[model samples]
Target: MKTSNRSCPPCRSWASRRTSRTRFSEFSPQEARNERLLTALTIDQALDARDAFAKALYSSLFAWLVARINHIVYKGSKRTSAISILDIFGFEDFKENSFEQLCINYANEHLQCYFNMHIFKLEQQEYAKEKIPWQNITYTDNQPIIHLLSKKPVGILHLLDDESNFPRATDFSFLEKCHYNHALNELYSRPRLNGPEFGVRHFAGQVWYNVEGFLDKNRDTLRTDVVDLLISSSIPVRYL
Candidate 1:
């Protein structure tokens, strides 16, 4: 098992870090409030840890519940195979920062990178096996999403690097040139009253949707040809 040595909010290490009385001795309102939240979280972590420890002592309690449920559903099936379905919430947007959030984000990123590398390799292998000309494959399969997100100098992260303009000025047109151009455009084109379909792109390692306002707002230097590609609803912006 590959384990992370990083701290987690609901884990033992974080609980130990806040095990001092001086942590709550602050008198200032903001400091007091922060301390209270941290203390509450620490207590929650301790209690959760205690409960987990207690589970081993009372293992039969869980076993009995599982047995009862299985008995009710199984109906004396000769061969029973238990399959666990795990659909962990892939990436999280949290209200507060914690070790769990960091771990989840790290795992999500790691999985994404791993999957991208595999996909790239798989595509290359399949192309090789079929003896397909490398240059002819649509850009969609060739460039995985991670390549875009992790691109240097002109990538999305690069454009959003300024703290003052964190979620502001961005140009996503470069994505059209991505190896996954068709997949990228399909995602960027649609509005999202849809469900989990949006995140499917993220699993592929690319940010599907981007802000056109941000792109248009600062397009002159970042992307000169953007004005020509601008498509509006009412007014037709002729593409020359």
Candidate 2:
């Protein structure tokens, strides 16, 4: 498979031979806006924005590579046989779990659920239906957990995105919403009402994810200034 990385303007600008920040008219409207937004950010916010941009760029590159590979493989081809390889991260429990860990664990939960339903659940139902002699097997049914993490409207991911839509939503507010919707759920818990961390009980173990940079990471935005700067042109990283 061919690989290509979609680099940001700021990165490209830094590598340019002759770098300078010209007038606003020299840059696109989005680039000017990006610069303004970036200049206004606190040191912490700027750092978070940087990471978010990196993740976004990686996601875009991965998507482009997948699309390109698919196009090459499937263009005018009749499918007779196909093979797919699945490789994904496993459940994680670190001292400080964050947005990435939360998502990874959620995926693991779904995989486990799929196994339980097919191997443990469906098999038993079929056996009982056939009236065959068998032992009643008890498995850890993770339906409740699957519902808690991904159920409609109130799922954690859904709630995060919903809060992200609001211009003023903060991590604390997101946490509040999470706890508010899942107060009765045994699988979810919070040490404090407005804490930076929330705990979830997964099939493997319990994990607490910090919500500090969750919103910014979820945004995956690149300021216009960044695009303009990274392009083959002058971009002012520091004001004169």
Candidate with maximal lDDT: 2
**Which has the greatest TM-score?**
2
lDDT of 1: 0.38
lDDT of 1 by residue, 163-234 (tens): 224343223433333323334543233335532212224443333333333332322131111222222212
Weakest lDDT window of 10 consecutive positions for candidate 2: 19-28
Error of 1 at 46 (Å): 6.2
Regions of candidate 1 where Cα sits further than 4 Å from its true position: 1-88, 134-240
After superposing candidate 2 on the true structure, give the runs of residues whose Cα lies further than 4 Å from its correct spot.
1-40, 71-83, 128-132, 192-194, 228-240
Candidate 1 shows a clash count of 7
Local distance difference test, each candidate: 0.38, 0.72
- In the range 120-219, model 2's lDDT, one tens digit per residue, is 9899999999999999889998878888888899999899999889999999899999989998889998876556888899899888899988887787
TM-score for each model: 0.28, 0.72
For candidate 1, give the lDDT of residue 221.
30
